[model samples]
Target: MKSKWPEKLRKGLHAPADALGNLFVESFHYLALFGIGAITAYAAVATFIEMLEKGGISVDDILLLFIYLELGAMVGIYFKTNHMPIRFLLYVAITALTRLLIGDVSHHKAPDVGLLYVCGGILLLAFAILVVRFASYRYPSTRVIDANGKDMDDGKV
Candidate 1:
């Protein structure tokens, strides 16, 4: 019969190795998120400086800034809750599309086509947001906030 000692020794070593792998993966995840948040913050500041150099800010510039704000807020929410909310993404898309429509309206060869396409996209996004809101309200998640405002699935509020 083959010796069982080697097999038992290998099994004993597996647990710590698996744990270390998990720790590395978790650490990398957080590091990537931090990098994304930092890049977004830097972009916002750079945009602000460019806007100031252009003499003054306009509505399109403000909307662009709002998109950047939404991006930062999305990253913050994900870090805080580990759950990304879809509404923030929708808000970002809507703001960006609006900014594009506003800034490029004068440049389009046929304004009607560009306006119709952008307006259609915005309408679709707004409809999707409404549907998501309705579903969330109708079929609420079991997760609830604790006193510290953290989500918990343990049926405690």
Candidate 2:
């Protein structure tokens, strides 16, 4: 006689260890997401305070603001989609590092060779990320289709 429970459900019920492991993994993921959001919020406030203190805003400062906005948007997207796009985070980091280097250049009297090298490395990484983002946009992993599996050419998907 077949049991009333579905096979998949029955299997899961039989493996309490697997279920606990999955739960722990999911809990950790959420905890980390919250931690990142908290840190980003603090950074955004700090950046705004510094901008106010400087009493002058430049293109690079504006870009730093954009980076903060992007970080918030990333968190929002994660909440909405239950997935975080590493690409978005990479873009934010690139903008942030660039802004940091620009600000350092503007405020410091002496040239720091170490910082210049670090900035160069950040620029290279940003270029790589931009290339990857362009390639992904040009060739998506999956095509969106309608209910009947017809490709939706209107870009709605």
Candidate 3:
């Protein structure tokens, strides 16, 4: 005759605890995404307005805007698809490096080994992106989205 009290007690306590933990996590996730999206949007608009006031748009400003756009897109995709694509971040990084290289060359006007390093870094990042794309294409992952738009990655009923 085994006592069923311990099993019942454990189940009674664990279910609500797990549900509360998930609730907190979901709340933080949405709040963080909203804050990031709002800040990125604000920065992009301020940059655009500043460029308008200056009466000219430089390559650097355009690149900055592109970076902000990518950030916002990443956040949006994460919210909708629940998956963030690494390619967007890579694109942002490459664009930022190009902007830096351009700004440096325009100001220095001299050949520098640092420029070679920047170019090498850009090439490496490009290769990494290529690898990621190839792998993703070759081994596509399947996501099961229910009517509620949540990912069903786990095999839980």
Candidate 4:
């Protein structure tokens, strides 16, 4: 007796519409990336112009600009090389947190509360850095090579 499952599977696997759908999906990827890049470029330039018009840029403003620059750079690198350096995100987050803390301190009326928030933000940043370092040390992206040139995944030194 022939099985009904294999007959159905063979018919479904060779469907012509699936191939055409994949082509459209791939084309959309490039269009989306280009749109995102254009938006980011416009924002970065506009921000720089506004900062210049203000006569002087403050540390908080500089930090925010750096965050935007890093974001654009990260997107550029991702498209160029299909890999993202996680450390770049970490740096951006640190800078953003620093900017938030600074802005909070400058504008807030209560010194004690501002100081507490600043300290908390710093502590959180330090902890995140430590976790990233530990993870990298334990499971490095590059394989460890022996004298014989065989790559090893084992973390043992």
Q: Return the top candidate by lDDT.
A: 3
Candidate 2, pairs of clashing residues: none
Better of 3 and 4 by TM-score: 3
In model 1, the runs with Cα more than 4 Å from the true position are 1-11, 106-110, 143-157
Instruction: Give candidate 1's total backbone clashes.
Output: 0
lDDT of 1 by residue, 1-157 (tens): 9999999999999989999999999899899999999999999999999999999988898998898899999999999998889999998999999988988874445577768899999999999999999999999878567789877876543
> What C-alpha lDDT does candidate 2 achieve relative to the native structure?
0.82
- Point out where model 3 deviates above 4 Å: 143-157
- The order of the candidates by TM-score, greatest first, is 3, 1, 4, 2
Candidate 4 stretches with Cα past 4 Å from truth are 1-25, 142-157
| Ten contiguous residues with the weakest lDDT in model 1 | 105-114
Quote the positional error of residue 154 for candidate 3 in Å: 3.3
TM-score per candidate, chains pooled: 0.81, 0.58, 0.89, 0.68
Q: Which residue pairs overlap in candidate 4's backbone?
A: none
- Model 3 local distance difference test score: 0.93
lDDT of 2 at 149: 77
Candidate 4, poorest ten consecutive residues by summed lDDT: 148-157
Compute the lDDT for candidate 1. Answer: 0.90
Question: Candidate 3 residues 48-142, lDDT tens each?
Answer: 99999999988888889989999999999999988889998998899899989988988777968999999998999899999999999998997
Q: What is the lDDT of residue 103 in candidate 4?
A: 81
Ordered by lDDT, highest first, the candidates read 3, 1, 2, 4
